[model samples]
Target chain A: MATWLLLTLAAAAADFQDQDKQGHPTRAVLLGGSGEAHWNAGASVGSPWTTVTVQRGLRGGWTPLAEVQAASFARWQPAVGVGKRWIDRRWRLTGEGTVGWTLQGDPIPFRGPAAELRVKGGRAVGRFAPYLHLGMRSSRTEDRVETVSGDILREEARWETTLTGALGTGFLLTDRVGIDIGLDLPWVHMPNPSIPGMHIGVQTGWGRNQ
Target chain B: MHTHGVSMVRTILPFAFLIACGPPPKGVDYRGTRLAVVDMHLHPGDWQQVPESTQGYLASRFPFPFGLRPEQVAEGVLTGEAILDQLDDAAVSAAILFAVYAPRTVGVATNELVLRERRADTSRLWGLASLPVDRWDESSEAALAALSEALDNPGMVGIKLAHAHMHFRMDDPAYFSIYDMAVAHDAPVYLHTGTSPFPGTRTEPEYTDPAYLEAAIATHPRVQFILGHMGYDFIDQRPGDADTAIDLAVRYDNVWLEPSALGSRGSDPTGTNLPLVLKKAKTAGVEARLIYGSDGPQSPGFAADYLERTLTALEAADYSVEEAQLILADNASSLFGIPTFKAEK
Candidate 1:
């Protein structure tokens, strides 16, 4: 599934590159809902968690994003990503990739990184736009300590991948003000342990592009 | 500009309403049944009586960084009502208190102190007589006599031996009589089974090794034994000692492992070692033998943090609420026959 998603992303990137190269003079900031489902040893463990993301767009269609997420098990993850966007008279699209790190030291110490890919699309109305997003992510976690002689003393790691989708409306209140509300759903991809979860978020931002 | 501000408010108001009415955050609801906590290892020292040199020794051994004077260390010692206050604040229903009897390393907090405190509140404080068998005249009979008298205190739940600090092995003949008395009384025996990093104290790992207790555990199956620290060697990166402890717990049905100082041990605030130990227990199918202990209030403000960390780790590991309840209190409650509260409906 990860291989398929990676190939699909590559094809989408190629298609975007071949489109008519047109640049818009605009800068925008955005806030939205984010979330993920985590699995270990082929079992659904942690509860679903809501996450908040803040993003700022730069010139040349580049945007940088940051997010924070946590759950009741004292699980916490903070992430950062960058992406490219394309906008037209009645439609907007974006593709982003991010890296995240996990922290929770008991039952076991989890130390590792996760990489994600997100593609989003929106339809423009008078001043409000409703959007949908599809994303995929993979994570690698391990806890271990070793001796100076390069002996593996203790080690434990779990790898997982998830698919996510979201629905939301973006409101352009003025030339420089906007607000966004969204519901995020994430599905863990594993047999006999398909735990699903939902998260909602509201984000308000200011930028000339609105 | 005024119209633009009004438009912004109009747009933001609905978003705020949506947020206010939205479902609670994901994964925020813990399904595990909450159980009353019983702290199994607490050393409420008589800090004022400790000599300046010993205070200095303790300060040096402070798990986290220390910048306090010896007097400050002494002043910070939680005693009398202070111990109760901390327990209340941490929501711990009861604690098993131990006297410190390593006379050579640190002056004794005589068994009398533990008995006295336990007398103040038997329901909330259980006493464990600390035996400095090494300090007793080299006669097994003399040590057994001292232990027998301490056990005579109805409030004393068990005997605590600082084998590592006093430089003695568990299987040594000098302590066999004390073990016999503990078995006769049906009192559980608590042994310090890990290496300590204190600068002035004896730290021979062999003396505290869990493997050394094999013969004793086999000979005295009636006497339950709690291996404090699960034989962890905090100063080292390897898991050899901890594995040894886990192996012992797996091999001996009468043995249980308590991760007391792993979280409070200053060095690994993240307590990565705990998970490793828990993972091993699960693999060995010995989760029932794992108990919760906070070697604390000794390091003020540690009880709460340690409990939170242990619970979080347990939850993250996919341990069922029933399992969490067991580790949190049921195991210790059943082991020591202490009463615990049930989850409120």
Candidate 2:
């Protein structure tokens, strides 16, 4: 489902970019890595995750984006949102808000809706851009079969919130392609799998000149 | 573009610096506090040697409450070497092995097997001789002789009796000689004082009641008596048996409560009635008399789950690290006269 969502978004973004007479950036990015990559390899909790996102520049400083995250443990999430960017001299400021739904099917199948807000800032030094991002997400589940600490128990919908932050440097390989490396810190305190204290993620993106 | 870069940096750098300098991680470091773990109740015997009828009964009751499956019980039967490997994986310093003494319903695990295993690694394994009351002669000479022989073995630290399966009252005078022998040798006497899970077994709860041990405890005041299950009444969930067990421990300085069946309900750190037992023991001011016991290797996955759940439960209940340490190993070390890991260190 996440893959299909990504493909659909990519197609829509490509069509929008082609129809516009003015050259605008149309970007596709891929995110893939284990949450425990920075910690011991054996200490990984849950599963490795991959995400794909497509963003199309709109009028003014606004951009519309869509993303999908696919993971082992039968987890899938699809999100859509709009972002605004402000460029002042050598730095760029960005903010985005997304609403998504999560589906899981390990111990038992369950689905939940989630909302996230992210803010980021980056400064371009020649071909490299170093950036920092802070994000917060809140999720709530519908009534589903719940596995409470490994025991099968039926529970009503519940809400959970997580805070995430990242620091990274993006290298512009070409005018249309770039690579990013970052440390992702996701704070999840619930009694789930052992969440790694820190994780490293690498993402690649292709885009046209703005 | 230059202004854009400077403005963005100015807006985000301070926030980034603040977040990067934030406090480390919240929550306690559960693994940092090292505690020597000693499992005071482990049935490390070959289940293949179990009676055919008993095997059938266990097999039919697949998925026992304590996360034990009959197939896993058969598959998990470990040799002496395998037992050591399990202990290493669990970070357990030592374990007390019990030979099941239910001769009538289930075949007895010979004292010879337990002695041999303990002798193989005396530092890590301790043996408890199982005495069959039915095998005792009219004068109880056979029971006394067996207990004496077991105590003679350097690896045998105690004697275990199954009153439920053996159909003998715990306070029966016929077993007084065995208690006397334990006192003479300074060995603790372990009794199965709880409900057995075997459905078709000939066990009588009345025979195994914790209250019956009062007379025996009084009679053998010098001998240390360890209640194997703390008089757990699993079927009825009655608090009476457990209260009696705690009262006995509180009343007698020589009595201890070993919660072997505490982890029988899977890995819900707080599952089972163990926390209740701990709370009661704390209130009774006999918390030091509480000991840890897995009663395990019952299934392939049981031992680890048992140890993890037990520790997690203790930590979750806000048990002081010192109190948890005592229950984990110190109490057992003092009661059995075994050298604790701290002493060796």
lDDT of 1 by residue, B208-263 (tens): 67888888888889889888888877566334477888888888899888887775
What is the lDDT, from 0 to 100, of the residue B276 in candidate 2? 74
**TM-score attained by chain A of model 1:** 0.61
RMSD of model 2 against the true structure:
15.6
TM of each candidate vs. truth: 0.54, 0.54
Error of 1 at B296 (Å): 0.6
lDDT of 2 by residue, B1-345 (tens): 999999999999999998887532211224467677888887766666666556655443333111113434454554566666666556677888887667556567778888776765888898888676775667378767876887888788888887876677777786788888897888998887876655334346557678888888998889999887788765555333778899999889989888776446532233747777767778888888888888776555566667777777676666787888888888888888888764222
Worst 10-residue stretch by lDDT in candidate 1 chain B? B62-71
Q: Runs in model 2 with CA error above 4 Å?
A: A1-210, B1-32, B60-76, B135-139, B200-205, B237-240, B266-272, B343-345
The candidate 2 chain A region of ten consecutive residues with least summed lDDT is A33-42
Task: Tell the DockQ for candidate 1.
Answer: 0.01
